[model samples]
Target: MLTEELLTLAAAAGAAVATAAGTDAWEGLRARLGHWFGRGDGRRGEAALAELDGSAAELLEGGTPTGGELERCGAAWRDRVVATLERLDGPDRDEAAHDLRRLLAEEPTAPKIHSGDQHVQGDIRVHAEQGSLAAALINGNVHFSPPPPPVRPEG
Candidate 1:
């Protein structure tokens, strides 16, 4: 049972694994993550590295794991991270979380599009119908309705 913070960090680790897939940052991030999870054990690091590679491969097997696929990937990574966190203590856990955050910070989360109120990501080609929804350009090409106007309260 991981704390909420650790769980969130785990999710970040998962997202980093997915977002960095097929990019140059993948290898470095993977190595760093493996070493961190390994916690000074070469064999442990290698095992973690193998698991990371497998996760990335599985997520990208069909296509860019977007939507549900992406969610699953993130969940899977979170579980692995949680398991690792459970086995660690004090400095080890802190260091692991810090390392995971560093990896996440170094990797940018591709791009996202909003569907109604949802933030969706990846190389999605939006074909939004119904009025000017297709005119929203985020990060230069993608489009959405700017997440709807903020509601104002009584004056």
Candidate 2:
């Protein structure tokens, strides 16, 4: 059983993880999350990173953006975070909760973007820089395609 504070921390971590997916904040969050759960273990960090990636992919193509799947994933992660916190005792748990709070504090300000239901008689280009392109439909039709990978600058 988690205390109310721990429960809130777990929920915040879960929601922040979900919200940060596909955004610029994701990589930083991922690394910090990996370190948090991994505790300086490389293998554990990689595994945690993979899980985060999988969650983002699933949420993107779940056919119900911002729907039940989101809640389900959030709950799943909340459980996982709570379980991790449970393993720690006293000062360590407090430290873990503080780390979680730090991570959640980095969440970017997400904007509500709704396409369609408006006049789109011209070209519509939605450049959602450093944010999630969620719940945006094309021509008022549902398109379940994942956004393309970000282009990297060549050095």
Candidate 3:
């Protein structure tokens, strides 16, 4: 089963990347994930967010994750985050690293899976930037289909 700390790391990584990427892509990805999780303006998205937020208290033990898992999660997060970074190429990779360092100074929120018995074997949090970096690194199966465009409220 997945540990808690790893999941939190992924979340922090994603959040850092997203924050570095800026709010537009981050928000867009958030909306996309909302659709994938069937959370379009519903409690589902809220739940999903709740599920992926908190602290990593008891994850990251045992031997390092398998090679396949690391590739999967890393690819997913790298795909979205790297793409966005490339598009918004104001800061270089080194800058992104600096941003990540700043994020580490703050306590990051942990990803809370609903069921404990059903272990998460891979990264499933849609975008690699959503939950645990380990999940992205380990390829936990937490992702689903992308969400539709978010509807804006009228003034």
**Candidate 2: RMSD to truth:** 12.6
- Candidate 1, residues 1-109, lDDT tens digits: the string is 6665666566566766666665656777788788887778999999988988887777766654556676676667767888888988899788777777666555555
User: What's the count of clashing pairs in each model shown?
Assistant: 1, 0, 32
True lDDT of residue 44, candidate 1:
90
Candidate 2 ranges beyond 4 A from true positions: 62-64, 109-155
TM-score of each: 0.64, 0.64, 0.25
lDDT (CA) per prediction: 0.64, 0.63, 0.36
Using lDDT, give the best candidate's number.
Answer: 1
lDDT of 3 by residue, 87-112 (tens): 43444544543443344433222122
Per-residue lDDT of 3 in model 2: 78
- Residue 89, model 1: Cα distance from true site in angstroms: 1.9
Clashes of 3: 32
Please identify model 1 stretches exceeding 4 Å from their true place.
110-155
